[model samples]
Target chain A: MKLTGAEILIRELIALGANKVFGYPGGSVLDIYDMLYKNATKITHYITAHEQGAVHAADGYARYSGKPGVVIATSGPGSTNLVTGIATAFLDSVPLITITGNVPTALIGKDSFQEVNIVGITMPIIKHSYSLRSACDIQRVVREAFYIATSDRPGPVLIDIPKDVQQELADYNQNFEYSMPAKTIKIDLHNAISLLLKSKRPYIYAGGGVLISGATATLLKFAEKISAPVSSSLMGVTAIPYDHDLALGMAGMHGRYAATKALYDCDLLIAIGVRFSDRATGNKDKFLRQCKVLQIDIDRAEINKNILVDEFLIGDVKEILDSILELLPENKNKSWLNHITKLKNSHENLLWTSNNSLTPKSIIESVRSVLGETPVSTDVGQHQMWTAQYYGFTKPRSFLTSGGLGTMGFGFGAAIGACVASNNQRVVLITSDGSFHMNLNELATAVTYNMPLTIILLDNNALGMVRQWQTMFYEKRYSQTALDRKTNYVLLAESFGAVGFKVMNVHELTVALTKTNKITDKPVLIHCLINQDENVFPMIPPNGTINDIIIR
Target chain B: MNSKKHPIFLLVHNHYGVLTRVAGLFANRGYNIENLSVGCTEKPSISRMTIVVDCSESLLDQLLQQLRKLIDVIAAERADPFNSVSRELMLVKITHSPESGGQLLEAINIFRGRVVDMAPESLIVEITGEEDKLNAFIRYVEKFGIIELSRTGLTILDRGQVSLITKSNNN
Candidate 1:
């Protein structure tokens, strides 16, 4: 069948199993919008208020459902706005596809209106990109983009289609016979097994790879088989069940005190699917210095890129773990396990703040108790750290937050994406006043979609994360960190045609959460005002190890 | 600042922006690319790039792995200095005259070079050999007053029947 490039894009998207697209349309993409109108039943085109929201929604969908999210935008500013969102997905290794329409091929270098070279602009961030000059190449580019975006060590890919290509006629083959490359990387686990068997204090430190590879179950099973206490990075917080006896929550700067301490104490650190980012490993020279590191990851570049490892098994982590489980015999280290259990127990009192005031701890506890296992997303700040420290998630892909990029305005848009991915199932967005202000414009999106999102805005009236750092590191001058954005969020939510409730205490929070759960037709905002003085504690300062932890 | 230079070869799809991806990867990581040469291979769909980057051995290995992950890149590998045959083409233009005659000619002959242009005032000699031999030829004729020089960076091929094409489909 002969079809235009615009129609071909829609057809190819449906063929690739990406039925949901989040984007904002404009001049260059009018032909695509026309085709979308023609094929609205097959693919749901979500119109976000901004391109950033669209890309983030796509990222959220990908993170939630483990499928590449597709987003579209027009040329120039429409595509430029996707930079932050694209970088966020790139840092987190989320599979995302961004399609932007460019000026016609004739006006490419003439500096025509909306003629930006997004392919060049996003070159450093995206996993791969394509600028389509011919309508015939669209099918191949789409397949390759999808394939590269979802393949080993997933990340975002971009395709810039010139307007003329979209309008050009091309022979569209429904079955173009695009075959994926065979996964032929052989795994060698002999050295890893030998190291694990002889080790006394073996600790399993896993990260986002476990979740991305769908190896969460396999990781837990392998951890249980070796009886190794499992501590995860912030990205891998939900990889291991929180209720599991050996799970030591999260391990990083703002990680659980015991988890961070256990890393240095262990003799053998079995890191799986972890890149050991600087945020996670404070001092690279001193991190895991006492222990022999064994890393298992799919990307070979990540092996010694961060910190050198004694032994590394490069391939799919789940495959490597399964092979290890087959031949490795179970071993128990009573002394090491006892020492860790004691550390965890002794550090519990110093973990975080507690009690009934409208605090992060109390608010999170009320929200979690009321809404268990519901997927939660968050923006970056003290509230983000608070949620990571307190909301012990049990389900994989349940705790979606930007770990690598630490994107401030990432929550509300992501929550909206999660809701769409979960088929209108209610999800929570925990954000702070400072972070929420960057993305409050997305509230109109949630309201327009009638998305079932229960937003728990922890308005601290300041950039509490930065304020805490300034208070401790600086002379407590409070510089620009003390922000008092007095926008009435309750009224703001109401203006967006959504329900909002203000809560100052734990009792009010519980009641508001219950009320939001009951109101399923529209999005609900629970504006929980937290104290500005509160900070995410148990923090290991930058370039500081477990020894330099701030407990007070 | 004595930085080690390593030659890396990448087999990539003959598509636009493929070169940019490789260069962008190096630039984005703050790694310096000393020289880069790219051309289409025997396979029209595939192009090859020879890149010399100032980096440590470990950094080259890490970069090779990253380059291989690119969607357009088919395979990437470090050209083993010991096992590979390497060549660099140097085109040097030197101030030449009948006054400063056969010493430059003698040197060019010693390096088995041919003169592409030999004016009364200058000489443009084209020589293709290992970098050391090319540098030696330049040093031998420095008294001739070299005017300009352009050199293609190192390109290598392993001394075996196996090639990156085999590494691509099999590895």
Candidate 2:
């Protein structure tokens, strides 16, 4: 259909699978807004109080959907306001298609009121960006922005359209021919198979990229065939079924003592679709000095990016894995499996003995029993670590947490997005009290959409992670980590037209979860009043090696 | 003995003011660049950099050991000299004039590059490869105006061969 740039904006959004956008119109984008108003029935645009919230909402949408979430805003402050959200998405590896209204083309670079070079400002933060220089370029830019957002390792892509471009007329009916680069990541199949056959202690450590590239089945098959235990990054929980004997739980900060220790003692490490972040490595010098590392990642940049690998394969996990399975060597390391089981048993026993307080493991177990393989998202903090440690994730797309950026206040909106995207499949958000407050306003959006997510608020009433560090390293000199203020969350939930529960004990938590499962009309918040001094132990302090882990 | 090539992870404070400073340092040093990757670390205030440069093995080691002395650098380490995971990101704008569809498809098939977007007048082909591969593709398509190009430096890992973090004691 031949249409103006403004009409193309609306039409392209529909083609990109955008049913709704979070944004507010302004003078700079008034023409586009007028076109949007006419097509309001086909698209829903929410006018948020702040552009930051709008961008974050879009980010939230992308996190759960694994698609480019769309956001729109006016020029100047409106475009600049989206920077924080764009940067957040950039850091956390989110796919967002953010469209910002720019000053009229002629006014650009003339310091027109509310004019800024948003494309330049955001270039560093986004995967790619575009400024609509002409009306004829709108369709191509929109299509390419989506491509960039969804390609390779997904991230935010911006399209800055000037006001004049929106008003200019153009033919918008164009089919975008899209094909992603398919470079065959070279895998040394013979060597990979041989190393697997030779290892006495072998383990599979999976990460978020496994889910991104749809390699969960291949990973599972490889693990089962080799009888190797599997450890997951925080984002990798869902890659393997938690009940499987080979599943060794999460590895990193707040990871199971057994899992972390197993990583230290393992002979061979098969890292698939994972970028060993600092949190996962603890200290590079002590992370994997003895083990032969086999790294498989689609992005060549990731191979040997941080920690060293003995054999690096630059290919999609699924393809490389299929090759390994085909090049099988007939050798089994029984002793390695036995040792891993022994370590796991001892670790489980230790966790059982250490249940002196309301720990994360207990909470995760409770939630799991109620919501098996349900999608759970978490904000960053001690609570995030706890969720990672305790939650037994079994299905792909089951656990959604930000590991790379560790962006606080990411869970609440993401939970809403997950709920919306997954057809009301109980999206549970495990958030810290501190993080919840940062984007607590998103509760209204959840209520507006009537999303039936169950939010578990770990109320330690402090920045627990920071407090733990201060307590251990700073001689208990409590700095700004203490959150002294209090707001009755039960009352807050009620105010937001959602169910609320305050849990202090296991029984209370179980009861609240049961209640949550029964009621699906609106979201639910269960505030668990946990110990104030709880610390995530076996922590490799920053720059400290695994040996220096504080085992209290 | 030729100094062995090593891996270096340089963590710098995250600031727009310093990216140019770092990139300039590498560009100005006349170092035979191999690979460089920069991304945000777990901490918001710092960025983790993975750089692979082939020099006299001794010089590479000595240079990294000295990188730790910079104030902007939070930490610098020769992550792996022998085994490591590394990759680079690139965006190449290749121009294939309207008359060269046959040549364009041939080039695409050869490099395994994808035609992400195209106008009636030109085509933008996207390819990710070793520096040499990209360079070769660029050479083949030089007839088309190289409108623009951007690249993410490089990122690397040194744990075991397969996983993000190794299960070994070093991890």
Candidate 3:
């Protein structure tokens, strides 16, 4: 079929399993808007108030759907506006395909109106981006962008198509095809297996790479078969069931004491499918001082790249693990397991109840007791920390919190996305009042999707984490942390055609959760007014080692 | 494969600061490169780069791919590997190194390898390979001194791809 570049691009998107696209029309994208208008029934186009919001909405849809999120923006500011959201997806490793309209090819770099170097602006943040000068290349670029966005270690891919290109006619084939090259770098399987067998106190610290590589089963089997203890990074939670016997919970600051201690004492630290982010390592110096680290990751730059792995294996986690399984010797490390269990039990006392009046941990545990292994997402802040500490994410994609970007307002949309992806699985979002304000407009999106999402507003009336820092380090010189003005969340939910409730205690929480769980037809927002001035304790001071942790 | 093959060596600063500039150029231009390795040179602050690509002599033009931007990558050149005396070290420990002492010794002799370590029951043999030497050694050592082995993946230098200073001064 003969079609315009805009039509061809949209058709390519449909071929890539994309149904919904979040964007807004502008002068530069008028041709695209016209094409979209003509074929609006073929694809769902969402007009968001802001380009940033539109990209985020698309990101939320992608993260939730396990499908690449698609967003569109016009030239200049429309494209620039998506900077924050695109960077957020880049940092959080979300699969997103952002298409933006550009100035006409002739006007490009001629100081044209609504012309900014969007391709240059987005180059650093995205895995890959292109400025389409040729209209004939639109189909190939769109197809490649989707492929790049969904490939190994998924991330956002941008396509900046010139206005003229969109209007130009082309022979449109409704099929997109591209093959990613198989990894050529090989890790010696026998050697890696022997290393595992030789080390007595081998421990596995898995991360988000496992989820992207689909290596969760291999990770679980490797840890279980070796009877090795597993300490997961925040993104790694979904890769392994939290309730598993070998699971030692999340590692690093705000992580379970046992998990951190295990990391500290481990003889062999096998990091699988994870980039060693600073948060995962309390301090880079002490992360694996006593261990021979075996880093199995797909990115070669990451191997022996950061935390200094003694043995670096560059390959997909799934492939490496399978090869290692074939070569491993049948030797059990019973004594090493017993010693680790002993060390793990020593910190059992730290798991005691927090004495703080409005403990975030208490609230999370209360919600967990009612929700029971349900997928939860949280926006960034002290509330995020509290939820990570208390939320039992027993399954993969069950705990969708931003780790790398720590993006505020990510929880609401992600929860909506999770709900959509999992066939209306109960997705509860634990968000602070601060992050809630950032993207609370997404409540409208939730309403539109009719997602079975429950937004739990951890209303402490202040930016809790920042306030805690102010109290501890800044001598309590409070800034704009306090949002004491009430915004009546019940009315907010009602305005969106969803049920809203306020919970005061454990009984109220359970009751409210039960009621929300039943109302799957529409989304529900729960405003749980938590105690103000709450702090996420057991913090490691900036640049401080794990041993320097301050436990309150 | 009748295509011309070239082995390029870019002696750069040991600083990892140059990798992005070098890799970005190739990625942006959509060049399909093969077998690239970067590591520290004999000098403490210098890095040796080994890149292998196949194309016509015009392939040298690909150096415009960010080579000028990198201040740390002192120079880059094509080298002939056949004439260069290249070597790679691999430590292989076999299971029967302890029980089959005669077999282990014979295998080590065949590969001209010396036992680097012995833990009563295991032997670690250090062997250096020149081009196809390591592959041949592995075939022989697979029977005795090879329980585990770690190879510092192929690093090479050219016979005549010396710095311009020496050649220019000589000329």
Candidate 4:
């Protein structure tokens, strides 16, 4: 049972049920590529156009499939290119195992041609990393990497192996049995349940953790059982269906007015799987000022890290919810529901816009109408917030956006990944001119794979978010926010062997969507010209309280 | 609130780049390590590091959590200043002359220091004690025109038999 390190790695990946890998080949990874070539039928390796694209594909695969995405890259720049995608996955808490091939072990510190300290470079961002010292450690390293990547608030983990180690022989017949120690769940549920039952206005604030832990069902059931309204952080948007009676869309800086108000006015806030990010809790002191907060998270570090809570339950969201459900009493707060309903109604027309030019809202709404329940990914900018405000996601993992890092150029690769992960489901990438321009090279990836993805490019010709801030705070002093570029997106897509459309009005947008729907073989890019002055609404100004939301 | 110095101890695998990972964690988090000393432990495979930081209690807690999360790190805990025995080693080179050599020797003897090396006009004195004691010794030796000084930062262990290493049947 002796095998080369490369073969052992492949076997371990197969053992872990990872059949799909995204990567590009390079000199340092030749031995691994050779092994993969020999065992090509076992694993499907998607050779992406760039290392960044490979990592994003893995990230997208992880997000949609609820499995650890595997990616590979060679040494030096090839490894460095995965930095952004790794950071994106790390910040978003996506499970990813990134394997990079390094220069031979002896040439490590000599600044060999393609050697880089990827471990050092990515140390802060990754959950953990290993630089292989010997070929014999490959199996254990791979197992540990996957275990760490997929468990306990999952994030990206990197394993760097030198070229010589990949070619070295190792015994691979050792028993691979390994299991994480069971975490002891400790919580005074009696007190927590009593507190919930006694509250006149109880609100459940769900975040990405609920989705990561797959606790949406429990969350929905708990909300329904207790008759408590549910508000979601941006990352937790799809935890409850948008049409759910108790669902208060997204709650944050650009959150629904009603949702933010509910958080502010609640008597009790049961926060689950959420770090009170600054964008979510504007002016932390004023956010949930009147509420007694009970925060539950798997990571103990997240508890009381931002806003202090009255009590905390530290464990997996699903487990903790199950425990709470067992001890819960039947209760209803009629007045609170009625008040929330009123707030929802009052802000029903808050999102209305009658502009003649194509808008982000109109574009997102059109996509939603045409592609129901389609997985939507977004590059960060005004378009990201607009999609969060508009897209109606009925399931978890259906919406992918870089919430924690707010990374631009993230959607194209992720959308390509989502499409691949979901068996070529009609995936949509809503991006702005600024964000889309960052990683436009990923267009080649979608076209190469013939991924069924639609690119909704909201071309504002400016960094709309920064421009909006400049207008509001910088005394109308416009700086370098404006791109004012003439590079045609339609031509760009067409050159990449994909159908492209340019729409300036809602009529053209709808017509373009209709045409794009017809061309399903390849990716479609729709360039919508939007107003540069338009801004995301209900924005809480920097360092401002949630109460200081600007409706305009 | 004024920052208080806290000594934190960590047991980590003796491997390349482990120190960088530990130091990088503090640097990335904006936590300043006031003093740090690292060396091999009783077990050659394990290295022990003592990092003294001045920060708020909450920030210290975060540092400990982050340190414990590192893959190479086996254990991380704060060394209770009141319940731990701490020491620092300092080597000071003082300018020696016919008139001041006697005074320097007398000062070194009073502070329980030993002259490890000597030249025509300088003596290298080595002192091991608590941080404050070393500082006091240096202060008394400075009048003789001290030329150079080197210090191995604080290393500490709990005063009791409580061990940081997990006990095994073999151990």
Quality of model 4 by C-alpha lDDT: 0.87
Model 4, position A451: C-alpha lDDT score: 83
| Candidate 1 CA-lDDT value | 0.87
lDDT of 1 by residue, A249-300 (tens): 8888888888888888888999988899998999888888888989999888
- Clash tally, candidates in order: 1, 47, 6, 0
Give the per-residue lDDT digits (tens) of candidate 4, residues A489-519: 8899999998899988888888888887787
Docking class of 1: high
Of all true interface contacts, what fraction is found in model 4? 0.47
Candidate 4 chain A minimal-lDDT segment of 10 residues: A347-356
Runs of candidate 2 with Cα error greater than 4 angstroms are: A46-50, A176-190, A347-349, A352-359, A371-373, B1-171
Could you arrange the candidates by lDDT from highest to lowest? 1, 4, 2, 3
Q: Which stretches of candidate 4 lie over 4 Å from their true place?
A: B165-171
- On a 0 to 1 TM-score scale, where does candidate 1 land against the true structure? 0.97
| Best of the candidates, TM-score | 1
Give per-residue CA lDDT, model 4, range B48-88, as digits (tens). Answer: 99999999887787778778777788888888668889999
Return the TM-score for candidate 4, rounded to 2 decimals. 0.96
Runs off by more than 4 Å, candidate 3 = A37-41, A110-113, A174-177, A180-183, A347-349, A355-359, A423-425, B1-171
Instruction: For candidate 3, write residues A466-544 as lDDT tens digits.
Output: 8988898999989988777778988988997888998777667778888886887777888887777567766767756
Worst 10 residues of 1 chain A by lDDT: A347-356
Q: DockQ score for model 3, please? A: 0.02
Query: Which of candidates 1 and 2 is the stronger one according to lDDT?
Result: 1
Task: Tell me how candidate 3 scores on lDDT.
Answer: 0.75
